[model samples]
Target chain A: MKRILLTLAVAGVLSSCGNNDTSKQAADQTETAHNATEHEEHGDHDGHGDHVASSVSGNTSVNGPVRKSDQASAILDGYLAMKDALASDNSAKAAASGEMMVKAFASFDRASLDPKQQASYDDTVDDAREHAEHIGTNSGKIDHQREHFDVLSKDMTDLIAVVGSDRTLYQDYCPMYNNKKGANWLSTSKEIKNPYMGSKMSTCGSMKTEIVPQ
Target chain B: MRWLKIAAVATVVVLVGIQWIPTPLNRGDTRADKDFIALYAPPARTGTLLKTACYDCHSNHTDYPWYSRFQPVAMFLGNHIEEGKKDLNLSEFGDYSPRRQRSKLKAMSSQIEDGAMPLTSYRLIHWNANLSKADEKAVLGWLKSEIK
Candidate 1:
């Protein structure tokens, strides 16, 4: 009878702990939703210099120095240009942007990165350059270009994860692409202008996460 | 003792009854023209390894074990294969654009090198699905040659 009572006491404690965990998880989710709303508000307030300045300073307080590199910024700019071209369904412009990105990647200063970052960047760039070249050569084949762009977006995401970004970027995902395997792309704006679907389904995706400068 | 006997019989009856609930099978009658093996034409050993390790999920045809016909397990395996094929249907490799093909090849090589394929959960049951050290070398070497 005493042993039975002990087991009941232990069970009560374990169940209570489980309840606490679930409540904590619920609170964390609410906090995350609050932060997402704040990010949306920040997007609306973009280009307002005072707002931008205050947010940058606020972020700096949480994170360390903002990672800034002219070469990385140039590569990011070229990538964004290509994204915009694809979103606009302009194959030739996308090809030109792809060529520009290949050059940007070629001239990227690796000396600025640490050894681990350099290794990851090198692996990513090799595949990225191949994708860019495919896009650059297949100017008229928009479908083929979109396929390449789909994979190239992954490489860009990987590159940014290692090299860091100069400005805030949004990672958007389209669930209907590639036979429902889904695909993701980075954008400078919060708006969903899906490059994968172009005008057919321009607003098909939603922002999954925001990458702020750190 | 009577209650224990009744409970045991009830469990057995429930188990047998559940087996009648059918699950969708991934087996296909014919090989696709764009099949990965047909397109790439890897060596015999590499081909066999891929079939054993990947085709069970990533291709249209799965070599179902006899036990896989049972309940709950069948549903679980069906869901797994569906998710896997969505990510990569190797049977339709030839249908992908050249750039997408290149990207997929690169991903395959990296996944193999990282020991992330033939997923750990899968290897636990399908003993032959585990890629040995030499298997990894052969697969990666073949993938590298094809990535270009």
Candidate 2:
């Protein structure tokens, strides 16, 4: 009986170690979901940046990355898909996703946006659309497509800065890209799996910052 | 003591076995026009100094040392080059935007002055990689004059 108990104890310890890693991964996913839901519910408000309503009084953590409309969310889905395709180094898939992004950008009616956000949205969408088209058109030329992706990422960053994203995002950077010129992209995961360098330098970057919705 | 002998033998065997495993070599012939010296045009002497001290880790091509032929050492050197190039790649420096070029030059200068670069650990193996105080000062001076 003692030997059986000892064996069980060892098994339990080993299993617990496995559970620890799973729990950490689960926590990260849960945080992303929690932030997404929070954005969806609170997204209707026009307060972005410094003027965010302090739900209570002194709590300013609710400041923002608030993409307040369905149009914005749809565009993000396409952008995320493109990001994943690039991460996988699938040029054709990336090009397809880029086309989807252009459609999403076009589908968004600027008139539907809150009057306060209209000017920024109009400014951001046109630039983002142009880059998306470039990325989509260059299906065979992956390197050139990636360059456009980098520029698209910058526009996306600017867009998110103004309106904010409903989903959690991380702004990642690879310093070695563009001949060590450095480039930025948005990622769903905080981990620095670079999309720019593809397989040769897949893990060659770091999270510059996070863009969780307020 | 008996267990220690067994452990030592096991370690030696593992070490020898690992030596046969090949690591990826970061050696490629990239064109000169794309290289940092050619792109930004740092002074001729300074460019040479940068190559001697920095290129092995911070460029696409690594000038591997004799020790790099061994397994564990090869892996270590490969990992270092991967990490180093992520932060700075001299071979692609010219391709950077003008703004990015200035930013990197500024960062390099600061890192040099702070003694946070050309990592001390690297200098231990390749003593020639060590930049003297005067050389460091001169590099920093050149950066100030040229970069800004």
Candidate 3:
């Protein structure tokens, strides 16, 4: 009877130890899961914080020193809206948006340009603006205008690629001032030049400029 | 299954036969009158990188892939090359005046920075053309230095 009692006591202790080990393992697993969740939450928080920091106010001017994100945003919005209008087959709206777009780009000061670039810049803008207006206003071939817009979009896309690489232009032209940096209209003298143009065209030697309001 | 087999055979036959079709390798009649050579004479390392990655299509001398001899694919490649070269030919880079060169350079940098050029689709097939963060920094660094 004594031995049986001893054996029963030992079995009870063993079963209790086994249950404790399982409980400890379960606790460790829960801790591990909690840690993983915490890490994920922390990562998400960091991402959100970055997004918040990079966010821009629409009306802000990107006039000198640091390029304002909002200026890029505004131009991008205008261009995209113009594209959207064209895509939707809204000729009047496209023309209007296109005019605004051209005007936005045209506001750059001519003095900033190297003489040849300046002259060419003016010519190209005039031609592009004229063609855009004609296409926008005249009902001759809306399809042709749309095609032209598509080509322009392509040219713009290609042009942007080159501009993105040319940070020098961004540094010199993207800002509102030069040496005499002070308050001025938010604009980018950042220009686009067509490298493929031969000498026959006057603007072929020039770059197109884009100017924006503060 | 029989129809599918016949269609597959027909497609293969047509594809093989197209290799014999002569395609015009038209090159632009680039003029020597412009300062084309002078401008591109001293290409920076960044310019070299751009040439390697983008100029295949954007320049006159497109390093055609061996497989470009095949039809449909060859035609598509030809069209891209022609259009790209038409848009911007680095071979004729020196022809533009300083202002034009500067603008073109700016446009080149802008396109790269914006993640637009060397289209992702093109890069998918040509893995070597893919730009890494380091490559981008190097290329943009050189381009940004040009404004002065």
Candidate 4:
């Protein structure tokens, strides 16, 4: 009887350890899901203003004028141009757009922005300029340019979060890029023309969220 | 007494039987030129620290322990390796874009400084993987310089 009881107890303890690991994994999954939902909600809130502006102006074009200053629009225009070029696998055009972005970022009017917005803009532009320079100078190295573009996309996302954009932008994610670490890029259309993979795996990504002009 | 003896034999049988259900190892034979070690070539000490502390999960090759050949434990480690590679693959570091390389370096520095890496569960088993203050400083210093 004693041996039987001990065997049952040992088995129970071992099984409980397996249960703990499963529960922990479940909790992690729930947390990730929660964070994704929160991100989507935040994007929707920022896009609300742009939705109102487009409706009021009766602008049927998705690229309607935004409430932001002209300087911000110029930066967004340059960024979108770069995004399109990268998608088309045109390194020379991407480099030109990158140079345009660098210029736009340099001349951006921060005086009109609030103190907090100024801080964010400064942080975003500083890194952005470096990435843009790398992209602009390495037109022959499309792979290198795409690598910088991946990071530049992130900087653009940060910029858009603060200043908003003149058009609705879809945030697309490619699971195959960056050694399967994945990468995100912004697009005007819902279709996934993966900027990271270009023509090689052009339709590899899926739209994660949409950023409406604020 | 007879029932207890039978149970013991059955348990041993189960343990030995499960060993044959091979868990796939993360070991990669080919050393890629794009490996993090090959790309930046950190000082010997810094390289050792990174290999010992981070590479098991963050790289394509894992120096698995002998006990890992056992059932359940091997699967557990295999899962961890898969998850870790999904976040960052140091073996494929050379393939990352310049911007990504910079950002990953920055992230490594921050994670080291914050002591969020070499995860608690991992450290519990692999004591040598624990980074002392000096190890942390050396790795962080190398990472800081590399990012620039």
Evaluated against the true structure, the overall lDDT of model 1 is 0.71
Chain B TM-score, candidates in order: 0.86, 0.92, 0.79, 0.85
Question: Candidate 2, residues B44-136: lDDT per residue as tens digits?
Answer: 778878988889998888888888889888898888999888667888877655545554576577567667678888888888878988788
Q: For candidate 4, give the lDDT of residue A121.
A: 73
- Which candidate tops DockQ? 1
RMSD of each: 22.3, 19.5, 23.8, 22.9
Record all residue pairs in model 1 with backbone atoms less than 3 Å apart, i.e. clashing.
none
> Model 2 chain A, poorest ten-residue lDDT window?
A1-10
Write model 1 residue lDDT over B1-148, tens digit each, in one string.
9999999999999989999898888966435578999989999999999999999999889999898999878988999999888657898887665545777886677567767688898899999988888888998899978854
Name the weakest run of 10 consecutive residues (lDDT summed) in model 1 chain B.
B94-103
Report the lDDT tens digits of candidate 4 across residue range B42-73: 99999998999999999989998888889878
Winner on lDDT between 2 and 3 is 2
lDDT of 2 by residue, A1-214 (tens): 0000011121221222124477744544444334334434554232121111122123334324344344477788888888878877888998898899888887776776677678766666665776687678768777766766775786676676665567777666555566444567888885556688887767655554556564
* Distance from true location, Cα of B96 in model 4, Å: 21
Give the per-residue lDDT digits (tens) of candidate 3, residues A1-214: 0000011111221222124477744543444334334434444221111111122212222222222223224334445555545445556676676666666565535464457645644544443444355445544344444434533443333222222211222111101111111001111232212111112211111111222211
Model 1, A1-214: lDDT tens digits are 0000011111221222124477744543444334434544544221111122234334311223224445578788888988998888999999998899889888888888989878777877877887887789879877778777877887786677667778877766555565544566879897778888888778765555456655
For model 3 the interface RMSD, in Å, equals 12.8
Supply candidate 3's per-residue lDDT for A57. 19
Cα lDDT of all candidates, in order? 0.71, 0.66, 0.45, 0.69
For model 2, the superposed segments whose C-alpha errors exceed 4 Å read A1-214
Candidate 2 residue pairs in backbone clash: A65-A164, A65-A165, A66-A164, A67-A164, A179-B92
